[model samples]
Target: MLTTRLPTKVEPYRLASSGKCLEGVIPLADMPRVVEAIGVQESDVRISLTFDIDSQRRSFIEGSISFEASLLCQRCLRPTEPEPLSSDFRLGLVTSDALAAQLPGEYEPVVVENEQLDLLSVIEDEVLLVLPQVVYHEEADCAVSRDQLASGVEPEASDAPAVNPFSVLRTLKDKH
Candidate 1:
């Protein structure tokens, strides 16, 4: 766990050239997009990033992000217990679309403008990607029970034989 706040922006090329590694924390409240998506956020996001020039001569950032979040439960429509979420990503830093396109499939291309990358934005993007599409508590913990979900009135059984509309069509065809 990192207690120091991370820099919001950095020069990826410079970091990569020096083989720098950054480990820090970003307050969850600072990321509005994440807050909006998760509904509730009360903790800091732990981030670790290593910047290096790979053997392929590609400058990239390998990052890991972890955080606890309280997401709205799809079943109960309420906030669930804080759940841990994390993501690991490798981003190839590029200054142009051509360079971005040349990056291999293993590396997701990140375009740097004016040689400066918004580190927070990248971290926030990873956090968003890691969020569960539909959050739900364990069956025992959920407020809405399976029985309630399956509780619709069952159709009453009748003694009469079922009538088929196709029977009339069959009768007409036989008469012809």
Candidate 2:
């Protein structure tokens, strides 16, 4: 629902102090790392972020991002239909590793330099985290059939009893 374009860069500390909320869209093509990982994307990524200082006086950014993208189907080795991906995250803004380590477990630490943060990069990283490790279409829709997946032939059942490789080891132990 957010149609406004989000700013590419901002000072998280300043925004957190003012308790600002930003909602907007970022063109998917603008994120190089995401594009490289998932291939070309035509849809825009919708994002919402709220910056505030917690009771502990730690500056943090809470945000959610949603987008649609086509991922390569592992079974078919082709692009599957566009799938929706989204993630919600809480990140504590920190200037150093020690400060980051001090943050509570619930908040992931995001190190900022010169008080500046790249909003797009942060959003893109979240998108990557939410991407499926393996993608596949529904069985009915997949180009590769179940039989074809088994190399187009049903496995034959052998008449002989199954042999256990461990039987030799068992015999050796018995002799010992």
* Top candidate (TM-score): 2
Expressed as tens digits, the lDDT of each residue in 1-176 for candidate 1 is 23388999998899999999999999999998988887658899999999999998999999999999888889899898888888899999999999999899999999999989999999989999998898888899999998978867889999999999799899899998
Off by over 4 Å in 2: 1-3, 151-176
- Candidates in order, TM-scores: namely 0.82, 0.83
> Any idea how many clashes model 2 has?
0
- Give the CA lDDT, 0 to 100, for residue 161 in model 1: 95
lDDT of 2 by residue, 59-110 (tens): 9999999989989988888888888888999999999999999999999999
